[model samples]
Target: MLTLCLAVSAHAASPDEPLFNLPLEGVHAFYPGDDPAFASVAFDDGDWPTLLVPGKWSESGVSVSTYVGWYRIRFVAPDDLPAGKLALELGLISWGDETYFNGELIGGEGFFSRTSPQLRSYAPSIYRAYPIPVGLLKPGQENVIAVRVGRHFNEGGFVGGPVQITDREPALERAEQNRNQAAAVQWVLFGIDIAALIFIGAAYFGGVRGALFWSFCAMWATHFAFIFTNSQLTYELGLQSLMVSWVGILLLGVSLYLFYDFYTRALGWGRFFPMTVLATLCALIPPIVFVVRWADWPHSLSFALDLAFQATTTSTMLWSFFCAVVAWRGGVRHAWPLAMSGLVLVVAWMAVALFASTDAVLQWGGIGVEVGAKLILLGAGVSLGIHFLDQSKRLARARESVLSAQTEERGRIARDIHDNAGQSLAAINLKLQSLQAKQARGDTVDAGDLEDALSFASVASRDLRDMSHDLAPAMTADEPLEVLLRDHAQRLGEITGTQIDVVSDGPPELGPQAKDHVYRIIQEALRNAVSHGNADRIEIVLSRQGGGLKVSIQDNGSGFDEDAAMQSDGFGLTSIRERTDLVSGRVTIEAKSGEGSVVEVFVPVG
Candidate 1:
């Protein structure tokens, strides 16, 4: 018989206790190679060196010869142990491990048959629990347990633990609860990704569409896939699961880069090709990493690949932080959240890289990879939502502005009809009535009276025709914009007796819609000059300069306060600004009291 001494302090057994936590007092390990005889009960490990339990072999005080190691531990069962099937529960084991109870093969993962030792079979970040046979333990007697571990990466052997022996029923119940908790967390994350994807997709397809929105959708979609592959559903896939997860992560990086690319552009920072280059690298690196890892590439090569993966991901995060800060400093809307999110990601990465050896730092700080990831998602979602809402609000205000302008124009048209056409018709009717009265009294009517009636009728017809023309300009679609503007300026000048000059020099070939807006802008400016400014001279210039079309309307009218006009609910200058914005152009108004006003518009062409 081989007797192993465990320096566990004696404690009285209690039947009511749910389980027993086997003390880590006397665990022995042998390094470098594996032997089937090492699992036999008669084999003596007395000469082997002692090691720390509930810890990795690499970190334990003893040195490990190779990637393979064997650990032997002895524990005594309680005298009052329940009369039921028992179980041995160990938390996560890095890479792989095989367990034997009293020389009988019981359970394992990654590490398989004594000769095979399949290291690729590892299941990461999962709890380990194996059922013990009914007669495997003798009450109040010592029991020996042996474990074979194969190290693939990081720290090997039992890297995670609360190693214990317990009743099979209780252990199963606890395992189920733990699994449910883990699964719940995974499902929650998956649901968040789904919700974000749906929102972004709808925004992209439903009118607020842009490159920025599309990239957000893609990022969330990739994250959803990553969550799926990393979840329990893919645990049986072993190494392939990790590969798929990595691929998803890499693709997510690509999406993030694209997102910032468009985001910066929207903020008026222009596009940076380096961002595109990083995105391309992220897109191309995944396949190579996947293939090499799947082919079981040399450890050093694999390490290099891992290093590259980390490098790209970290670089992407740093770049995101840089962009966010720059945007915020530049007074970009919806930028603060992005900056906060980037900071969180950087902090999380630092914590994982520097303090991953222990859980204490993450727990105490209440921030880790999981927390940081969720924060980032929250920040992004909030940012997108705010932008959408802002756009919708602006759109609503623009619609109201347009409706107000239409109503005011209709009022002006009504006033013109009543003042000009109505009065002329009334005068003709009065003259005819006077002619009938003179004929009734036997006095002949003068031919000059008939001529006066004809003149009044002609005036009415002209005013009506002018109103019709104002409703819709009589011009073909192919007509140049300058021709239409000059006709409008001439007509307005003929009516108001103002000297109007329209100088055109290489006017831009804007689309029909843009031309309409430009025409309306000039018309409003002219009307404002005639009515508000009471100016007698106006000059309109159309020219091409600096890759843009410049429309300058200068009037020697009684100009009002530009600031006050912009601040008020007036329609003329406001309409000009809104129309310019619709076509992605800029408008500037220079005016002072009793001097002159200059309204200049710049619209990018080509």
Candidate 2:
């Protein structure tokens, strides 16, 4: 018969109490690879090696981090211990664990049978307390507590944080408290990452939709995803273990790909062979490690391959650090923040890696390390925000400078044309008229010919004067746009031999810029009707609606397919559209074959 004893930490059972409380002293183990059949309570494991309860196999000199193991402990309940629904607290199993009372399954963290399968694993380190029914405990009789452990990920086996059987309420409260505390770290990092994501969205909406900003944002996002796969966190949140584990694995590969891509973008391609070659080697490391791991080679090959993978992984990581440093020194403004944060996280991870054999260190410090990994993303956020803001400011300043220079140049050109070109044309016209009069003095030319010559000169002079005036249209301060429109419409009607009806209603309270765009829009529409549609009559309507101005020009003549006209290089309509867009207005043109056209524009007025 196997006997085990466990002392109670909460409250030791008194002599008068019923022997319902079982204090586990130690367990008799039939370790994995020993006997798979010894899991039953009826199996004799008295001769097996003894292991302490409330501790992992690593405490018993188990060198291998991952394996399957079974632990069985038997204890006698106090005679006076109450027989009711007791609780069995088995805290924080790393991967998977199942509890059995007297060889019947009570519950499990992660369990899979041949017929049933679990899709994903959950949050890594959640506290668990299984309820034990009164029928399962025997007062003054030997009772067994057996646990099967499956170690698949990260510093494997049952974490052995806490073990006890106590009142149901306390057990539940303890479990809730553990979960809340464990979740705190995840929540902190989650907040930072989510906020950063929102900031990226804000920038996009604010007219900063550059693909480069979002490209690195994706990498930063994926970098923080690795923290979610911790088994306790998964359990706390009731996530699927298999799916979480798979995502965790896939994130590693995606991380590698993004790592390669980040450097590729930073260094650019084919520019420097040494840089590209190094990055290429870094990119190749993941696939090579995958091949080595998947091939399942011989022991020596596996050992050597594992070593090679470790070396390559470490080197690539170091190379990433080096690149960040190089970028920082090369005057990449955002590089230092990223490098500093990344280096801190790297050191934390390295410390964890160095002591992976020490289970206690991993259990105590691993969560902090995971949090640190996510915290580094804040550096990315700050860097991106500063960079985008600075870029926007620079662009704005550059635009203002360009606009100022363009205004100055336009003023100079207008003056030069009015002075030199207009004067020159006027002088030529007068000289031509004088020559025509002199040529006709002695009947050297026919009277009709002289008249035609003078007429051509007069037309040339008039056209030159119109061209000079058309170079730029200026409006005097406090002049309402309605008056300008009336003058322009009257002139156009006389020129086209078309009757243009100009109607204005309500006040014209538009900004100078908006009024300018509105006037140009109407002018273009009227010209297009006369020139393109060969319209004989144009109706121009201007009205103020709420805080905006609406203008419509309708003509009756040979109409056209509006789509074809808009798509084609029709200068009048194209200029109209451009002017409307300049004022952030909407313009619609409706026309069909053999039907007249209507062009309407809306410009907001201040």
Candidate 3:
């Protein structure tokens, strides 16, 4: 009776035989007879392989193998079933496979395989999954599953489970729902990452280190996007799947190098370039191998190269962790977030590496290490966001400090003028008034001494006025360039007793900042012409030049050497240069030992 039962089971549902009678619309379970060889074989939930019914494969003492041939299964649908479309769900396949149902071809292609170390190595590729649609399976009739799987040197065959059936509507609905949920989660994480990346990029670019830091950040964001898309959450964007995977590895490598440069510069640690280059070369491994595949290289070589690439990536990540630690030790004000983010990313990557290297972890618990990787990426994004906010606040404080320093400097200068020059001028003015009163009363004072005192008072008064002008120029107000320049020239002429000629034309109005710079430049130029050039006559000319205004102050005096004047120990000419620079203006000074000096300044009015 046992022999008869065994024979009945072997040929019970051969390729041409009908399936056991069962409900057409619900789930059913099929279990192969207890073969000791099947005990060690298990399905990869990470990449669930499909089963073939009514078939068995020979196995090595260790595991099942499907290298020799195809496997087939037969089932019969209920004849009373509705006429709607049907589906044969093949959970997953290993390496590659082709499926046929009812003597008609069904969809088949390469699915993500966790069996290969390459697929399992990365955090994004830990999940192995594929779906084949068996459309219109002729409900309530005999159906056959013929799967041709090719495996080499290892236990393979259909190691997963038998096929199942369901109505097309509910099956499609569930599949779509799963896809949507995955996409939503993936995109939410991606959006947060992108926002953090943008903030970091903006802050890095705005700071003193300039575009290099931002470039590193931008590349990092791109790499993260590629990784996110390749993850199990939304790995089905079609052609982009393989491309993004490869590109992500490449960009991650490149970004590591860039980050090395930026980190060193921003943090003042300059010894990390060598390690960065080594890491970059490691990142290049995958793309190189991919390109050389057309050469028909040995599979072992390709595998070795892939391992090397991963090792390099791992090393680079480790180096980043080291750099972060060093930065933290160096008292880098913003190091905490970056260091923590790097540490988390490294930990996440290491988790994936551990799982890929060992099969026992996957065998014991279905949950692979990729979940940790996703969480790590999320954490890194948060860290970056916090870092950017902190940096922005620091910049604001620095700017405030600079402005306060400028205000204090200006106040000190004002105080010095008041205490020394201002007080001396007041006393001189009082003595001059008393002397003039005595002279009018016929006191018979020496006219020469009286003249000398009057001259001293006048000189002191002019010095005080010049000091006031230097401390706070009148041009800071909403005054026109024409008016300011005219007033400045008159004051200079009166003080220096020189022939100062004033001329003006076209566009009396000027931007306030522009006018202020121009007035300061003119003031400096006139002072130089009077004190240094010793010119008896000075001509101040203001005229229109294109969309700007030009003011020329020429003195008929003993001009000094132009080059010597520039290199000399004097701040007057330097101050003129600085004033012109502030307004984006240009200044030209022409002078020689015997020739008169000519100083011209041009300022954009708009």
Q: Which ranges of candidate 3 are over 4 A from the true structure?
A: 1-85, 93-98, 102-105, 109-174, 197-212, 228-237, 241-249, 259-267, 292-296, 357-606
Instruction: Give the Cα lDDT of each candidate.
Output: 0.67, 0.60, 0.52
Instruction: Name the regions of candidate 1 deviating beyond 4 angstroms.
Output: 1-27, 30-51, 57-84, 95-124, 133-156, 164-166, 197-207, 236-268, 279-287, 360-368, 403-576, 583-606
Point out the higher-scoring one by lDDT: 1 or 3.
Answer: 1
Q: Sorted by lDDT, highest first, which candidate order results?
A: 1, 2, 3
Between which residue pairs do clashes occur in model 1?
Answer: none
Model 3, span 430-545: residue lDDT tens: 76777788889988667775676667667667667777766475557666667666676677677668777877766546666666667767766776778787888888888766
**Model 2 global lDDT (CA atoms, 0 to 1):** 0.60
Which candidate ranks first by TM-score, i.e. highest? 1
Per-prediction tally of clashes: 0, 40, 9
Residue 390, model 3: Cα distance from true site in angstroms: 6.7
Best first by TM-score, ranked = 1, 2, 3
The alpha-carbon deviation from the true structure for residue 561 of candidate 3, after best TM-score superposition, in angstroms, is 46
Alpha-carbon TM-score of each model against the true structure: 0.59, 0.55, 0.45
Q: In candidate 1, how many Å is residue 575 off? A: 4.4
